[model samples]
Target: MTVDDSLSRGIGPVAMTVLPQAAADDDERAAAHWSGQLATFGLLEAAERHFRPAAEEGDLTAVKCLVWLARQDGREREAHSWLERAAGAGDAWAMYELGVSLPRPEGLEEAQRWFRRAAEAGHALAMNDLAALLARAGRREEAKDWYLRAAEAGVTTAMNNLAIQHVLGGDRAEAGRWFERAARAGHVDAMANLGRLRLEAGEEREAASWLGAAARAGHQGAAGLLAELPGAAEAAGEAGLP
Candidate 1:
């Protein structure tokens, strides 16, 4: 497949490469740190091996990692104990994870509480997630506020989501600006949205540029629109551009 075809929708689920940053002052913490490093290298089995010892010693981070691994293994119930332990220890990420682990409706109120706690602790992901929950609860204004905060905190997905909200509210100019910001940050959906917005504004050349970039960056929506872009067929036919 061509690079564009392979990435027609997304880059796919690449393993996270960022190791957790922490002061590894104890044996368990050190092991947790090492586990994170191993996971960063996609050595998940090895990372889990280290986490066993740390979790046995009651290291919350290690426990949390086990929860994630269990969830990935489709044993969602297995995550609860570790997640609850870590959350009880005041781990913000753990709290957020625990909230999401529960099924909604029955768990919605409790999840919101945990999400609020995590967001108050400055978790940008929690802020964005809580915003989603709030919006689902018919609190659009509150959700928009959190989206604004998360976007300002450099969450590109939040920027894109906020842009969509603006689009819904008929503030296309602001939506365009936010979409541009998110598109520049490598959000393919935002790139596609921006390309469509540009096309709607009668900027066919710029739309083509954005759409082409979006297609190459893994947005199928942009790829589908490529042939419809003004002068696109002419340019592609003349230059053999895919």
Candidate 2:
């Protein structure tokens, strides 16, 4: 990946400059709530002034917010500490986000701990990410179990990944079933991949539809294959099929 993309992935999206919608509709408290954010955004002095009080008062939301800021500011140590505190306090989302943020080896172990905690608490993405990590570490059976957990929790990425695993394991039928689930959930890569696999199995009509769906979703390879279908070859000036 490009440096900019890599950095963007590591840091997450830009910080929101406003309060959440729930906090906004409270007419009386909205002003006070936003005043703190205004301070944070440089409209007032003491940027963290609003966040500090909430954090000190042990507000989980405030702790999460502070951790987000630390992540944005590249303060890994502070973020790590805050995440540990929140995760220990039974914040599944915090545990999952921390799992996603830490480094490998040490980070991976830490990530697994938080992910396992969050997964047990019913965090879908944590289960999915943890399954991916387990698969990468060559624990395929355990990974499949985690993938099933994430799939049960409605994680489409886990569905797609599990389909690939099935395909690699020579269980094409099962793989197709998972691909169908992922495609129905609008996973573009899964649609494209399933389209190709279907075509290889001589299910051209279904493959074309899937390829068309994937192409419409901006998968360039799918678009290319869709362009090569039947009459499309003639449109591209190729000779008739043998």
Candidate 3:
């Protein structure tokens, strides 16, 4: 399969080659690979062997991998230890992941702190997530700021969510603008929502374009909505997309 196809959907067998199964007397490298495999395959106990040694040895990458797997297994305390090591090693992604896995109190203060650190280190998704936390806590102005930053950083999901926030806040104009921005960036939900909005406003031609965009981008709900439109099937066939 092409690179785009591999990334466009769920993980496949070959793409999950980060981990391998361990033998009775696996070497360190084999053990590490096996551990990765165990995590990938959801064999939590079997994966521990791959992570434990390198984590104990202060290997940042291993600590990150183990921490992520531990979080998936709900072993938060162990994940915390590994995350601390990786965070201390200056891994910004580790800080972001650690923030997400930790428990929250009083509106994600701890998570915000770490997300801020990661954002400063140029982690776009962390910036978006941080914006969401801020928005949930009623820090709309600050949230908007972070959303703008993340959107500029090419995070299309952030752009779409930010547009939703604008819409929720009764700024349909701003929402439409941002929705268009995200749609151009290939955000499927943005395309669908924007299309729906236009349709509601009787902008049939524009709605058809956006709905087609959404369907081509694999938004199933948008595809269904498109099917409900007059002559939509013909439009979809003529588009020659998806």
Candidate 4:
């Protein structure tokens, strides 16, 4: 509710650094690909270098990248132009990004429309976002359905969120199953939550195991909780949880 779950997929740009040489070839599509790589690394200036050429050449991804960069620079008007350009061209990522970028108060309805457009286009991230919004609006059944669709489409965050919904519904076993599914996929939050659940159930050993893995994975909350367990540090090290 606070912000779009950019990290899950779609318009979420990854923080990266390396600029691939393969993406720098004479091909426009290749250049666009490189621009995305650069943008993912938070190398906006470098990303923009490639974005201009690719977007000018009509590369959809490059257009989306330009939108992302403009937003990062606080150029909302510029970003909107790029968003409109890409969306008009049927770029689902652009539609999804535009939805995420909309200003609140007047944004929710418009964002929902954009999300439906993108989701109908087979955008998994858009589906998940729409599901969250539906959930927030207290439409549990519809939210559950969308979450299932997204989770089945391999959105790990959807798996975690679905588990949360299960908890709210008092379906403890279902929650545990989904949490484990997400944790096994390397979801730190799911791992931590599962650890907490096990601890609450008096399954300290299982709790320590999950907490150890989440902690080694650099989840600070998991680490803090693990530290309070008897011999947890030594046990985690001995178990080679990392």
Q: Which pairs of residues clash in candidate 1, taking residues 3 or more apart in a chain or in different chains?
A: none
Candidate 3 wrongly placed segments (more than 4 Å): 1-35, 38-59, 65-76, 103-107, 168-174, 215-224, 240-242
Q: What TM-score does candidate 1 reach?
A: 0.69
- What digit string (tens of lDDT, one per residue) describes model 3 on residues 92-161? 8777876787676753788888999988888788899999988988899889888988988889998998
Candidate 4 per-residue lDDT, tens place, 48-117, comes to 6656887888877666667656666677899899888888887776778788889896799889889888
Between prediction 3 and prediction 4, the one with superior lDDT is 4
Query: For candidate 4, what is the total of clashing residue pairs?
Result: 3
The CA lDDT of each predicted structure is 0.72, 0.71, 0.73, 0.75
Q: Per-residue lDDT tens digits of candidate 2, residues 163-188?
A: 98888789999988998898888899
Task: Rank the candidate models, highest lDDT first.
Answer: 4, 3, 1, 2
lDDT of 2 at 148: 85
Q: Single out the weakest 10-residue window by summed lDDT for candidate 2.
A: 233-242
What range of 10 consecutive residues in model 3 has the weakest lDDT sum? 19-28
Per-residue error at 133 for model 4, in Å?
A: 1.2
TM-score of each: 0.69, 0.73, 0.65, 0.69
